[model samples]
Target: MQPTILITGATGGIGIALARLLKDHAQLVLLGRNPQKLTSLQTEFPEARTEALPLTDAQAVQALIETLPALDAVVHCAGEVVLSSIQDSQLEDWESMYQSNVLTALVLTQQALPQLRASRGKVVFVNSGAGLRASPGWGGYAASKFALKALADALRQEEPLISVTTVYPGRTATDMQKQVRDMEHAEYQPEKYVRAEDVAQAIKTVLDMQRPSVIEELSIRPG
Candidate 1:
């Protein structure tokens, strides 16, 4: 049987690219926050399941997982980014960053652990390059990503049955990247960055890897 994969942030650039690539290969369970986008995805991937779930809501995520009989993979593509310096950043800024970038991944993964262990599934976190280092104006965002990396690392150690991989992609040409450029007061050049499809292809590689050798981490950058 084809693997049953759950992809969060299914409406985002990388998520959409990945879903398009895997539509014929796997049973997709696309989860996103925007109801309208989820509707569009339902039309787009008629055979795939779609859910408009708030991943941060532990109760909601648990309730959703209760419906799934088998899940082979869970790819976390949902996240947010905000550029702020130490002096200008507000407390809520950090809180929101953690909530979106870190908590959602944690809550969803925690709720789905039982099935993952049963299926010996894969967990992929679509992390950012900022996760490895903190730029001047990117401290808050980086901190949250760093925390996400920590979560992935601990999961890798704790859940030996399930392979955990963190993918760090450099600036990609997406709407989010455009917003990031606008924040930096720079030009929005989609052509200069990595394509979302490339990232998706790399993720497919991770999910397809066979036994005895798991991809613990992967880093991708623009050419």
Candidate 2:
């Protein structure tokens, strides 16, 4: 039997690409918010299951994971990036990032722990380079990314049996980039953008590795 993989934020961008990349081999389940997007993706891969739910809803997140039959891996790619200077950053924006990036990942991890342990599965985090460094006007996004990275690091240390891999993908070509460009005045030119499929392939490679082998951190930046 093919191993089952659970993915969050699977309706778009990196998540969507990863889903498609893995669909040929794995039993894939995707979680997202848009019904139309989920419907469209499900049509493309009828073998994959779609769960339309916001990550912020704890009850919904818990229910979704608890009902899953089994899982061999989980890729968390559901997140938002809102940029603002530290001085001008609203509490609301910071809260939004925390809820979407930090809390949601934690909730999902907690909910999936049982299934993961049952399979001795892997947990892959779609983190950013911002998670590793700081820059002016990157306070909000950077802080959230750092927290997310820390969570994966801590998990890896505590659960050595379950591979915890964090992939820092630099400025991927996606709608998120457009949002960041508009909100932060940061022009993410295509010349510098890493194709989402490249990141997807990296993930598939990591998953294909032997159980004893582990990739703790992977950084993919455009050359």
Candidate 3:
């Protein structure tokens, strides 16, 4: 049987690209919030199973993971990037960013630990380059990603059998960028951004690593 990979934020962006790329390699268990998008992807990946839920909801996230039998991998691709200066960043916006980038990953990882332990599975975090250091306007988004990186590192130490990989991707051509550019008046040109498919391919390579080998961290930036 093909190994199963549970992918969060499967509606679009790198998540959608990864699902399409890995469809042949793994049985995909897609998770997302939008019913229409979930149904659409389910039709596209007819062989894969799907769960539609807002992952920030702790109970919903836990229940969704509990329903899975055994997973070979879990990819936390669900995240949000909000660019606001520290002084102007609203508390609510920071919380929202944390919910999307940090809490969602935490909730899913915590619940998926048992199945991952059972199979010695992999946990791949789709982090951001902003995670590594501070950027002026990236206070909220960067902070959340930094927290995610710390969590992934700690988890790797605790669960040596279950490999952990964190991917730091630079600006990507996705709806998330569109929202930022549109709402914040930032000049985010999608044409200049990295192709989502590239990130998906990188993730596939990480997943195909041999046993006893782990890609602890990887960074992908567009030239």
Candidate 4:
């Protein structure tokens, strides 16, 4: 049987690209906040299951997990990026980033633990370069990603049967990157950033790894 892979942020640029790559080979469960986009993706990949809901809702995520069959992998792509310097950042901005980037992954992973353990599955986190090193005017977003890295580390240690891979991609060419550039009044040059398809391909490679051979972390930057 083909592996069942669950993808969060299924409507986003990287999420959509990754889904397109895996849909033909895997049983997919696409989760996102937009009902219309989820429906559209479901329509496009008729064999896949789609859920339109907030990933941060613990109860909702648990309920959704209960409905799923055994899963072979989960790709967490849902996150937020709010650019602000430490001095100028508001508590609300930090809170929002924490909830979206960190809490969502935590809750979803916790809820899916049972199924994952059963399959000796893989967990992939699509993190940012900021998680490794924070740059100027990116304090809030970077802090949240740092927490996500910590979470991934803890999960890897706690779940010995499951494989965990954290990918840090530098400035991917996505709508979110455009928003970040607009916030900084910088030039929005998609060519300068990593392509979403490249990130997806890296993920595919990691998922293809066999037991006793695992990639713990991967960092990808634009050429």
Best by TM-score: 1
Regions of candidate 1 where Cα sits further than 4 Å from its true position: none
Off by over 4 Å in 4: none
Return the candidate ranking by TM-score, descending. 1, 4, 2, 3
In the range 1-223, model 2's lDDT, one tens digit per residue, is 9999988889898999999899889999988878998899889889888988767677887788777788899999998888878998898998988888888888888778888988999999999999999788889889999999999999998886689999999989998888988876667687688999999999998888887898889999988
Q: Which candidate, 1 or 3, would have the higher lDDT against the true structure? A: 1
lDDT computed for candidate 1:
0.95
lDDT (tens digit, per residue) of candidate 3 on 135-204: 7888888899999999999999999779999999988999987987876787878889989999999999
lDDT rank, highest first? 1, 4, 3, 2
Whole-model Cα lDDT per candidate? 0.95, 0.88, 0.89, 0.93
Best-fitting candidate, scored by lDDT: 1
Clashing pairs in 4: none
Of the candidates numbered 1 and 3, which has the greater TM-score value?
1
Assess candidate 4 and give its TM-score to the true structure: 0.98
lDDT over C-alpha atoms for residue 175 of model 2: 87
- Lowest lDDT 10-residue stretch of candidate 3: 53-62
RMSD of each: 0.7, 1.4, 1.4, 0.9
Q: How close is every model to the real structure, measured as TM-score? A: 0.98, 0.95, 0.95, 0.98
Which scores better on TM-score, 1 or 2?
1
